[model samples]
Target: MSGTSGSYNAVTWLLDRNVDEGRGAKLAFTDTVSELTYGDLQRQTRCVANMLRRLGVRREERVAMIMLDTTDFPSVFLGAIRAGIVPVPLNTLLTTDQYAYVLADSRARVLFVSEALYPVVKDIVGRMPDLEHVVVSGNDAFGHKKLSDELAGENESFATVPTHAEEPAFWLYSSGSTGMPKGVRHLHSNLQATAETYGEQVLGIKESDVCLSAAKLFFAYGLGNALTFPMSVGASTVLNAERPTPARMYELLNRYNPTIFYGAPTLFASMLNDAATKNERAGTGLRVCTSAGEALPESVGNAWKARFGVDILDGVGSTELLHIFLSNAPGDIKYGCSGRPVPGYKVRLVNEAGEEVPDGEVGELLVEAPSAAEGYWNQRSKTRQTFQGHWTYTGDKYTRDADGRYTFCGRADDMFKVSGIWVSPFEVESALITHPAVLQAAVVPEADSEGLLKPKAFVVLRPDCNTDGLYESLKEHVKQKIGPWKYPRWIDVVDSLPMTATGKIQRFKLRDGAS
Candidate 1:
């Protein structure tokens, strides 16, 4: 592996070098309605690169992508890098205010938005002073530069601009659970390290595999696992431009026969609950399954395996680290634990005093990975507090067993006090999720009239389950599993719990709503 000081760009390396080796290699992109071959993909990307250069997109500038998972995303993503511009992929689902924050924060010079989303931001573009260009993908009301017109009659021999390995290549934003979203910057080498560690070691992707993931390309996990990993191994990928429902996902699997499926635990739970209806269409060529973004309950894991005949390997990753740092391998998976740290990454459990904790004790999980980001962009104080020495202090809390498996407790900030005793929301939430009636659960502290805080639970019930007396039943269930003190004083049954774009339960939302 080359050191970080060397000059290398991931997009140029993967496309140019790989094409020189064998231009006939296969890469497929199948959306809900369309598909493209590797040869078509390579030519389109080069054309887009040449067009962007002709449009005066300068080196070291920021180009924002607000499109969903489509063929154009990869083309424009690689095109930006090939033109020496940093690609900042923004979540299309974010509110206009959130989008404005990112555009202002990144100082994006151009925004490539899909037609469906163009109307949402059409009136707001003038507020973004630094934005110099707007490229709309589909034909609609916005009279912006059409991406198709730009690629018309363009040559496919655009030279990739050479970049230093340490130069900024991309920007991914945090979930903003604690505050406003922070931009986490990564170098080109970080992408390569992530592909080598998580892609090769954990995912075990091969050229023959067809990779499919429910996460969007804007997310770090999806970008690494779904797009970059498969590209690195010369495999095919399935991209759905719409929200991936269980029924729709099953249809895609039946149609495409993807070999590797990656998604969040929430998606897995929904699929497991609705498997019987989709079983007849479920005879796809899936060989491996993976879950991330949140902890996978043992019951969900077991149910998915029973239905799909393949284990759903659980892993934990963060935007700061680029991709999965801990994951269970194919044959070494455990039912109730997130597997040991992946290769090229180090994990440690630290106490409140910042000392190493014993194997059986719960503490903060700190990570040291070659793919970890340099720091939060332009936030020196936060960068200093979060990154200490060579390790990134992940806010997650966990317990390590003697066998080196890790059990997630909760976030360090999520832990709160009740009756002067520390409480872990995940412990109670996990116990609640095991109940047959509960599909999902989120626990948080709520204060009463006396100014004393107590545990409150927000639960999403399974289908055909009566909410009558169900809250009491769940309270008793938790009281019996953990101590009575851990029982929630108030329980609210709802249709769904608030979640971040990455599928993490937003406990702070519950706390705010309850107040």
Candidate 2:
């Protein structure tokens, strides 16, 4: 691996280089709906670059994508990067108002959208003063130029725009759990660094592997899972345009038989519950299964391995860090601990005073990696606060063992106090999910009648589970797993938990709705 200095464009390194290596004839991407070979992918991306260039898109100009997980999504994204245009992949599940805010903030000159999604943003596109063009795929219902039409007769030999290694290549919006989503700007070399360190060194991604991720291309995790890792190593990926329900996932697995499957804990829990209800094993040909975006409960891991005969390697990463820096490797997976930092990254558990803490003591995690984002796009104050010097201060809290494996201890804000004793919501939720009937659980501090804070759980029960007296049984189960003091004083069985677009539980919503 080379140092992060000198000129580099990720588009050239990931795509053009693979073509140069004579792997262009190999399959690159596939979904239930479509498939593209590496040669075809390169040609389509070059067409996208030509189309953008014909539309007067300039180097470093921001181009936003609001399309689903199709071959065109990666084509447009890499095409923008190849042409030195900053690609901003927006979440598909966000509200129209949120989309309007992101479009206004990014001041994107052009937006590439799908026909299905164009109607949602059509009324708002005219209101965006900086938006010069609306490029839609599949249909031209709004009189916008079709992406396919623009690509017709386009040459397949566009030269990738040369960019400095430090220049901004793309931007990803944060989950915005704390506030409005801030654009995290990543450099051209950042993708290569993560692919080399985590993808190559940790995941050992091979050209023969095929990947399918429940996390969409809009997220950093999904981008790495679906595009960066596979493209970097000349591997293939399966894309799904629709939401990855358990049923849909099973269908994809049976059809594609992906070597690697990436999903969040929420998805895993849903799959487990679904499998349990169906009373049949969901077969998959996965060589490895990964869990991230949130903590993976021990019980979920155990049950998944029992049902599917594959271990779920839980890890941790952030939008600012590009991809997973801490991961459980193939032969050394710890069911409950996030493994040591990747070879190219540095990790430290720091106290509130910003000093390193001793082993087994919970503290905020600070990570420094070559692939870390430069800073928030337009947030100077926040950039200074989060990305200080070389280290990026992740808001996640963790405790490291003597052997260096880090155990997640929930977010700094997610930890609350009960009777002057601090309680970690992740701990309580993990305990609750361990119960046989509970599929998913979220714990938040709810105020009692006397204004005292206590832990309250909102749980999703597996289908056909008896709810009568199950609440008391869960309380006792949690008490036995942890301790009496940490047990939820109140538990509410719910149909489902509030989740973010990327499948993380929105604990704040539960906290707000708690009586």
Candidate 3:
């Protein structure tokens, strides 16, 4: 029988494997305030498991983690998994109403919140009838018990529950194009699949490499980058609880000199646009960087490479798939395209009728990966629509080239026709971003005087950019670059564009004219 054949727990596979391999003394995690070696992590994780059991959270029951990225996060997340309890990591930046919605939807028995974020849901915790215990990492304020106090009494001798590899292990609320957040349920085996496929084969993560993810623990990309990938190889991770700003990111990179850095397109743009640090180089130890959540513009990728001498492997992934299934490798880098599918995954593009589209034609992307989520929790119709047989429908549009590289088009809902032809907003935005004055941009279709749909651009120009007649010049620049027909009919300067917490452009909100 295989190692995972009869019974398997991911916690044992991820955490214990490192200890069993004599890596217990090696550092596993480092945050601003403290560090956890592999041995300390194991002990703390076991303590967290015991603490959960003492609270009466049964096996297969859910525990919600509204946690920041810190040493506490790993113990809580992996501990719950070790005891056969599913841990749902909610977005820390979410509003109180959103927290209430997720708590009500998941019916979690326990909530482990960071002390900093406790007040957001302090009043609502008592209102959640399903929540039996509130454990805070820093304080016991507002009637919530301190997580440290609870774990202090618990001995680190709990046995890892024997759970099937296919059991639901965790949940993440997806930030989709147009809908309330939906809980995407992932199985235990899914984490290992991502680690083996993308983490091992694509990124070549090693035991000596240190990782810093600008994205937080609540994100699927960040979870794999900082936790599963590192633990799979017994590497250490640097966690930052606060937001990833340009200055702070630079400081971390200089201090830690991490081998790998995971970031998003927005961060890359901001880092490049900020003149003070735009020319700065991270430590020489930085070997590779990655970008996801949104398509990286070709200009931004080239600028970053020119400055840092490291390629940003632009990839596509979602909460449903757990981590990146399509990515650019180290040597086979492409500036403008989402690289070919990662090994062990199958990708297809189909038209509205679900027929496979030929190369160079736009279609919705569908993926079949080992890490695909089981389904959305308690949402049957949506589950049926997204997951069909072995294939999970990704709500993204793209066109595969003759050589098999996929170029991202706009989202399925965001695409609109202009002049009897479909226009990709990303394509136009990419063209606009290539200009010297344009710092950031978002494109959406708007009706013209003749009632014909045309492209409109909202741009955040560089600090020294003169907007006097700049729109006309930008239009001419775009016309000379992509094509005359695709240039923005109108360009409006804005301080900022609407964006989700994951750094994706909220084009739907821009379309609705919501600031």
Candidate 4:
């Protein structure tokens, strides 16, 4: 049997492992007004687990949660795990139809929703025949039991259900940037492996540190930042129940004074563009900042450092990998490049023939990590194609340096051919955004009059910029920065580019002429 074969419940190992070791009194999670000590978290999780079991939630039964940055999210998530139920966290920003699709696909029996989000899915709840109950936070007016009311009567002493470490613990649906989202199935030991490797070795998360993430708890990046990493180290996390706008983020940083901050490149760029960000940065107490979900443009990174005096450690991970497998560590960052693989994970850049590519040549990224999900839920074809034995194939393309650092070269599907030559959209987009007038940029191949495809750029210019001569100016800037052939043949200045919930530009939508 493997090391992960024994009966090992993750919630038990994470929650009850250290409650008697002097960490019980420490702050585990907090919002603006409410907080939960480690002791309080342990008890609340137990209560939630007991309530779910009484509701007839059996082992491996799915319990879905549509929650924001509140304490209820983590409490219910851990509680589901304690009773051996699989917890599925859905994206809060998704449409009601999208939520209905996931609930139906996952066959979830019980759903926990926040009061703010319940209204979005209330109409569709009747359409989902598989869902038996709806549990809501803040208020019970939405034809469901109040989460607080249910936890009030239950005692906080349920026994942790025993299960193998490889057993299913949770499921996170992939951000449906391509098409329909696929459910990624993670195991009991996956969270702990990432916490020990990435949390301990890469980020050096400590008990004294207070963490804040603009990324919400639903996405994988935010899940690690706000829940897994902080809880594993007994650190406190500042929760933001509201949407993370520039103003809200600035207020949280000034109010909470967190030591570590996590955000995607879009969020960082928004803060850099906001003039009011300067007023709130006087005493943020920030020591480390992390960026993920998309490649952090070098220009954006440089501007953030110049204004904030903090380096954004850019990294790359996916829904299948659970957390960051490759990352830039503190004091060891290279601008615009995803750094070396974190400890305990092996990364390979392989050609289409499954052979390792030479240095400086682009190839598909293949990762082998213990924290990786078992496979996509109910996706046998995708599982066989992506996960071969211990190696999981990442669809993104990259090139490696002699120093073992990885540089992202866009997704395999994002690479397009132009005039019989291959072009990387990310490379061209990076060059386009360097122009003074360009705020954000995305490149895609558009057909010319001759029916041959050429690079076309969709750009969002800086506020109050002259749009009269901007199109030609951006084209010339790209030509000067990169080669003429790589320059965008047609440039369209737009108000804004389409984005995913995780802050990544949805290029597929742009390619379809939807933007």
Top model number, TM-score: 3
Give the C-alpha miss distance for residue 1 in model 3, angstroms.
Answer: 11
Runs with alpha carbons beyond 4 Å of true place in candidate 2: 1-4, 275-284
* Pairwise TM-score winner, candidates 1 and 3: 3
TM-score between model 4 and native:
0.97
lDDT of candidate 2 over 1-515, digit per residue (tens): 44247668778788888989999899899866678888888899888888889889899889999989998898899999888999999988777888898999998999999889987897899999889998887756479878888788888889878788889999998987856789999988889998989899888899999999999999999999999999998999999998889888887887888989999988887787775345544545688888899988888888888878888889999999989989888888888788889889999889889999999888899998988898998899999989989899998989899988998988888887888877889999999888878878899998889998889999888778777789789999999998998999898878888888877888888877885
The root-mean-square deviation over C-alpha atoms between each candidate and the true structure, in angstroms, is: 2.0, 1.7, 1.4, 1.7
lDDT of 2 at 259: 87
- Candidate 4: lDDT of 364? 94
Cα error, candidate 4, residue 209 (Å): 0.6
lDDT of 4 by residue, 1-515 (tens): 13375789887767776587789988989988789888999999999989998998899999999987888888999999998999999999888888988999999999999898888999988779899889998866476899999999898889889888989999999996776789999999998998998888989998888999988888888999998998887889999999899999888888889999999988888888876665558236888899999999999889888888988889998889988999999878897899999999998888879999999888999999989898888889999999999999989999889888898878888877776766888889999888877788999888888987888899888887777777777788888887788888888878899999888888888889922
Whole-model lDDT values for every prediction: 0.83, 0.87, 0.91, 0.87
Please identify which of the two predictions, 3 or 4, would achieve the higher TM-score against the true structure.
3
Error of 1 at 503 (Å): 1.2
In Å, residue 319's CA in model 2 sits off its true spot by: 0.9
Model 3 ranges off by over 4 Å: 1-4
- For candidate 3, the lDDT comes to 0.91
Off by over 4 Å in 4: 1-3
Q: Write candidate 3's Cα lDDT for 164-207 as tens digits.
A: 89888889899766667999999899999999999999999999
